[model samples]
Target: MSFMKKHLKTLTIALGCSAGAFYLGWQSPTLMGDVFEQQQVAQPTPRFYPLERFIISVPGKEYQHYVLLELALKSSSANAKHQLAEADPLVRNSLMKMFAGKQVDELNKPKNLEQLQQEAKDLLTNVLSANKFAVKIDDVLFTRLVIQ
Candidate 1:
């Protein structure tokens, strides 16, 4: 209907103008105001933290390399030590996975290494997030990913 089309056009114009105005205001630091504070509520609660990097051996390999991840874990040193003590098998299984889900090209290509690393991180995050209680790892990183 013509009426519907007109109302839609008006609504679109109003929304676009409002968005442009908000963007301009944000760019002008002098106009920083309470809106920023109100927007803060949309953010997620900050509890994820990165754990320290570790070098774990890969299957059929005789060497070890440091792996990094973009996880949100805390350095509860005592808790980590205790948990590892209690769940050594589970820990080993998780670490071994870093080597399992890999292709030689992905690990070897310097140009595509970033994409590979991101994929690894996403994979590890999905795996760890499933176990938010005991074997909880916020993310994974690969600091020294050498295939040797």
Candidate 2:
């Protein structure tokens, strides 16, 4: 009974100190609002721009092959996507030229396709920046690729 009484006093004082610290450390609504705003400013949302299907013909050894490609691009700027849409014709023309030059055997390889996607990304970034577009594409995703 004596031990219980002595420990109870220590527990009560500890609780009081913890309660006081918590009360002092609690944030106000304005401070919380500022914290949330900082988090939002630090992280920006991603944006995607999808290009339509492209049917390109490349000459094979015995016959001409048809390649179907669909591309989606990712970036952080809406204005860049808008500019890409506005200059769709020029972008398509450039990509078509690149695609038309690929050999059917090369396109059939998975590694080559990955290289193609990377090349497309670099090419698109260069073209957009050179054309004075608002944003450059960070990635190129091939949603579909079929060769026939």
Summarize candidate 1's per-residue lDDT along 40-144 as a digit string, tens digits.
Answer: 435333243333444443343344433333323432333454553454444446655765555444455688766654655555545545655244433334445
RMSD of every prediction: 14.5, 6.5
Q: Each candidate: what lDDT?
A: 0.51, 0.84
Worst 10 residues of 1 by lDDT: 69-78
Clashes of 1: 11
TM-score attained by model 1:
0.36
Candidate 2 regions off by >4 Å? 1-40
What's model 2's lDDT at 19? 92
Query: Cα deviation in Å at residue 14, candidate 2?
Result: 27
